[model samples]
Target chain A: MKRNKAVIAGIGQTEFSKNSGRSELQLSCEAIKLALDDAGLAPSDVDGFSTFTIDNNEDVDIIRSMGIETLRFSSRTPHGGGGSMATIAHGMAAVESGLCNTFVCLRAMNERSEARFGIAHMAPNSNNKGSGSGFLEWSMPFGAATPAAWTGIQAQRYMARYGLTNADFAPISVLQRKNAATNPLAWYYQKPITIEDHQSSRWIVEPVFRLLDCCQESDGGVALVITTEERARDLRQKPALIAHATQSIPFDTETVTNFYHKDLTVFDSGVQCAKEL
Target chain B: MTTNVKATIPANVPATMPRPQPLPGRDSAFFWDGAARGELMGQRCAACKLFRHPPRPMCPNCQSVEREEVRLSGRGTIHAFIHPVHPMIPMFDYPLTCVLVDLEEGIRIFSNLYECEKEDVRIGMPVEVFFVPTAGDKQVPVFRPARDAKAGSKGARS
Candidate 1:
């Protein structure tokens, strides 16, 4: 199979925190500017932008703020967290299609300090009427309102089938905290949670999850720059060559997915994506 | 092991916090409507005879546009559950034992055990469908201990 080549030229991110004390737009601009600087590219050199579809900041607003005059390519991916890694695929495609030379993928949000995604939103369909995809409505009314609750539904079934326990999942968080403790950029930097801490943590919903089971919602943003492999070699820094990326597959496992397979615990889409990648 | 003769929702639950209602859309209206009458309903792909939940328009197995409402046994076993300890959302009954039950009909539903404490619920615990009238003209299909749930009570470690 023939493929076009692209490379990640630079990466930039704001400090992780419960509060960034900055508007999302400002955070976005700051991250993007840092990425541009890291890539040794001027604002004028960036011609395209790609990000998650739910982003509040408009491309017009971003490019204008960056002083990039003529934007040629821009795109956004659906499904919020899935969009994080998915945009790199979009950027690669845009560059391969000759739509733009330099593509910037960015995301900025004040998840903890400003708005939150964990709130028990009214209905999955929402009273906002005709607002969302309505997938959430099925569980929302029953109190599986937050993202943790949403995923916990699946996690619950997985544990029950295998007879797994909290002790099984505690090591995952403990190891993550252990790693984060040494990383100065981490929210839990210099502070690690113990197995005891995980065991004693309060529940957000029961047997399979605890407060430590969840990642603390942090404020801030991150940005990345993508360009052609040929063009990337000429940039200021060593290019992180894009090995491969997967297409946007439907992330929803319950509805619109194949159930013929034996175990619902294993994600078929992920298996297929991994095999392909 | 400690066992409660009967499970119960905490007494102080706030009715003022309107329970989140099912947003029944065109694809799932039938399932929601059926639940209102105490029936656990799922969508059966007319072409494949496979059953599914949180109803959708077509069959993922056969790509068939045709589907039919399949009444379910409403009898299932606890597949997995979490005892949410924190009141991140004050609306939730603290220490809520949220569960995912794998129905005998080959689908999973997110619900809670109405009559048991967090300790009483267990993996593979048998439960039967029971309706909790949450909002006007809408009822949420919840689960409670089935008659045989006690047989599996030992499955619970705590």
Candidate 2:
């Protein structure tokens, strides 16, 4: 594949916290402003916008509040967390295709303070359409209401097929905390954990995941500025050139709750994305 | 190891707060209807003869809009199971176990497992489907250890 001349000019984020004490839109605006300032550009310079479909902050609201002079491109990627990085791909595509000269990509979530993903109950069928509803109709009636429950069932098959034990998962959590301990922006800054900590943590889903194995519910926002490599080189920051950016959703994969797929042990989408990259 | 944990909705939850019911849509009405009628249902691609669960309008294999409603054996092997321990919903009892059963028809279903000990649940264990009442007077499919399966036989670790 031919490489694009697009580059990431700047990145900015709000402080990671349990309660941001701000609306999701406000958090988004703050992060966008910070990202613009870091890139030595004004809101008016941004011609394209991209974000995850699940983001509560609307592009129109952001544009009206930020006083953007013109807009040429905008897109919303689906699949929640799986689409997080796809926002950058959308930006890169816009800039490289000359649809827009500069792009702003963002994700602002008040996940913890507002609706907690871990415990929030979604009514089955939820108006009887879209990706997860059909799967939920099958699973939720059986008491697997949460993402943990659904994912744990899939994870168990992989573990059992491979003859692995829960102890094998401890190192991942331990290493993640160890990295977070040194990063000032990390919520777990200076709080490194051990494999023992992971082992002793209470089970969220027995024999599949411990509490430590899961992500913390957080409230915050992050934004990135993308532009052509030539334009980025003229800006204040060093340009990080893009090599390859892509997203994939292979056949038989749902956004989540993928028990219907032929092989539970394999992540076909992730494999497809890796092969593409 | 069979503790015989009663396979029913948690007793403490008030009758007014029932479990969410399956709202069947055009593509999936037959499957839920089959559950209510105590029959396991799936769809087979009319062109390719491939079986699909949680029925959809078209088959991925042949892109065929034509499909045949098929009755499943309701007999399957437990391909995976989990016991969720935290963030408990009121409508369900604690120590609840959910399983992904690979049915004899080659399709998979997500359903609850009962009439077996939590410790005894294992991947590849043979199970047979049974209907259970959920909210809204609707019946959903669940599974129990197959009656003819020998006791004390461990599932393959590999």
Q: Quick one: best DockQ, which candidate?
A: 2
- Could you tell me which residue pairs clash in candidate 2? none
Q: What is the TM-score of each candidate against the true structure?
A: 0.85, 0.92
DockQ of 1: 0.44
lDDT of 2 by residue, B1-158 (tens): 11123454332322235555677888988988888898888899999999987688889888999999988888888888998777777666556788988888888888888777788887888888888776777778889888866675445312
Report the lDDT tens digits of candidate 1 across residue range A206-270.
Answer: 66678898877888788999998788878988998778887635434532222223565776667
| Candidate 2 C-alpha lDDT tens digits along A1-277 | 4434988898889988899998999899899999989988999999999988667788889999899887899998877588888888899889998899889999999988996778836565453433344566777676776677878877898898898878898898888888878968767789998888889989888889998988887899999999998888679899888887899987777766778777889988789889989
Chain B alone, candidate 1, TM-score of 0.82
Candidate 2 docking quality: incorrect, acceptable, medium or high: medium
Compared with the true structure, the alpha-carbon lDDT of candidate 1 equals: 0.73
Among all candidates shown, the one with the greatest TM-score: 2
Residues forming the 10-long window of minimal summed lDDT in candidate 2 chain A: A124-133
